[model samples]
Target: MAEPTLHIGRKISKVRELKGMKQETLASELGISQQAVSKIEQSADVDGEALEKIAKILGLSSEAIKNFSEEAVFNIIGNTYHDNSASLNYQCSFNPIDKIVDLYNEKVALLERLLQAEKEKNELIKSK
Candidate 1:
């Protein structure tokens, strides 16, 4: 069987989407029109120089963009989230409520210091 052709444009589009970018945004970055970007996204292949520019805008190497796979990305994300040894934990080690209370206490302490300083200024004014 003949090897299937790689849709470079589609890979670029998927990478752009994964990066939360719009075609208009990519167009602006490339100094091209939105229609041009759309056309590129629909193309089966892209030239090396244009591909380099797109890869740069997407914050990846040309090879990375060329080899981009949605399945690989999802697999990595899934594994990262599921593997506790992967150091990608989202759980907070410290209590958020405690942190909020600490911030509130600091603000209160600052206000108290300001109030004491104002009282001192008032006492000085009275003596004058």
Candidate 2:
């Protein structure tokens, strides 16, 4: 039987994917090239500092990344959704609609910041 190896890079890649982040985005955040990010994903092990930085960028702790298991996640989802008990009550901490509104507001704020940056860039070009 082949021994199972602890692939930290794969865990980081999976977490980044789950968080809806692209290699380019993660690369930019980490101040590394996209190719470097790709290499990291293919690697079996990453150093402690790099792993910590990647974990932070993925919005997770290093321990979370180290302990990540796809099977556990699927099992949790299956249990949560497959439960048919009438007394099984699941209450969300926040309203879904409110979360949607918050996302929209954040998007609008990002657009505004982008517009401001573009305007400043144009002003600089005009002055040159």
Best by lDDT: 1
lDDT per residue as tens, model 1, 21-42: 9999999999999999999988
Off by over 4 Å in 1: 1-5, 83-128
| Superposed model 2: Cα runs more than 4 Å off | 1-5, 83-128
Worst 10-residue lDDT window for candidate 2 reads: 1-10
TM per model?
0.62, 0.60
Q: Which ten residues in a row are the worst by lDDT in model 1? A: 1-10
lDDT tens digits, residues 1-128, model 2? 22124787788888888889999999999999999999998888888999999989888899999899889889988888765554448667699999999999999999999999999999999999
